[model samples]
Target: MVKCNTMPEVRSEIDRIDRELVRLLAERQTYIEQAGAIKGERSAVRDEARIEDVVAKVLAEAERAGLSPAIAEPLWRLLIEKSIEHEFTVFDEKKKKIASA
Candidate 1:
């Protein structure tokens, strides 16, 4: 990470980071869609145990990466929630297509 000498430099770095974050999120979404397709049932889309496991793993990684739990925990929870919602949508769409075929 470059040390920002001014507010403009800080903003520029933030913008760059935001772009990278979006790209990474898009990649993650692809896997979420694949999961949607692979799961056998709609009830499997939201796994409580898996959600907790993911949160635990992310918290551990955040500790190692020096990211504050305050930020990481809620951020990941929301991200997971949104991903599950997207997965549910994908699952429904696939099921609809299969039924019509």
Candidate 2:
């Protein structure tokens, strides 16, 4: 881990990490869109069972990463909700393309 000696260094490191985080998020979004394309119904976008499964997985990963589950759980829940909305949009657009074809 890189040690920071000043506020500027800390802020710079955080900015760098945030950029990497966004890159990872974009990669995750591609898979979410792929799931939308594979599923037949918009109703499938919100899978409660799968959500719990994901939460459990994230909790475990958080423990491994030394992150607090208290924080990770809520953050992931929001991410999942937003991802579902994005998936729905992708599904609708694809359906429209197919119907028009």
Candidate 3:
């Protein structure tokens, strides 16, 4: 992290971080879509055990990284929820394609 002497510098660094985050998220989304395709059933898309495991791992990493649980926990829960929703959409679309074929 770079030390910023001005508001513009801080905002610039934040903008850079946001762009990087979006790139990483897009990469993650590809894997989520792949999981959707690989899953044998729609029911498998939302795995409760996996969600808890992810949250636990994220919380541990957050603690190691000094990020606040108040921020990390809720942020990850929402991200996971949205990812599941996206995976469902992907799964359904593939099913539709197969059915139509």
Candidate 4:
């Protein structure tokens, strides 16, 4: 048998924070969907400046939180690339509809 140290008092707060994190992620997805709408009017270009700005913000926040900026930068880059792909998909679908009409 293994004995584990546990703090029952703060566990509820941690659980609440986790739920909030999930909620924020869902909200973020909605914004990504809107990003697709925005892309429809813009050029089909992978804006490196946008990506750099996102990376800088993520790294800065991670550093402020006493976390590893190195890991945060790469992780954020991955997320930004995925978001761009999502926006492109939206733009492509909208374009098709416009062409077919």
Error of 1 at 17 (Å): 0.6
Tens-place lDDT per residue, model 4, 23-81, is 98678767887777766474753789888987888888898988797788777788778
Error at 75, model 2, angstroms: 0.4
Q: Comparing 2 and 3 by TM-score, which wins?
A: 3
TM-score of 3: 0.98
Off by over 4 Å in 4: 1-19, 41-45
Poorest 10 consecutive residues of model 4 by lDDT?
1-10
Candidate 1 deviant stretches above 4 angstroms: none
- Per-residue CA lDDT of model 1 for 20-86, tens digit only, reads 9999999999999999999999999999999999999999999999999999999999999999999
Best lDDT among the predictions, by candidate number:
1
lDDT of 3: 0.98
**TM-scores, each model vs. reference:** 0.98, 0.95, 0.98, 0.71
RMSD of each: 0.5, 0.8, 0.5, 5.2
Model 2: lDDT equals: 0.96
Off by over 4 Å in 2: none
Worst 10 residues of 2 by lDDT: 37-46
| Candidate 4 local lDDT, residue 94 | 77
Better of 1 and 3 by lDDT: 1
List of clashing residue pairs for candidate 2 = none
User: Looking at model 1, how many pairs of residues clash?
Assistant: 0
Tell me the RMSD of model 2 versus the true structure.
0.8
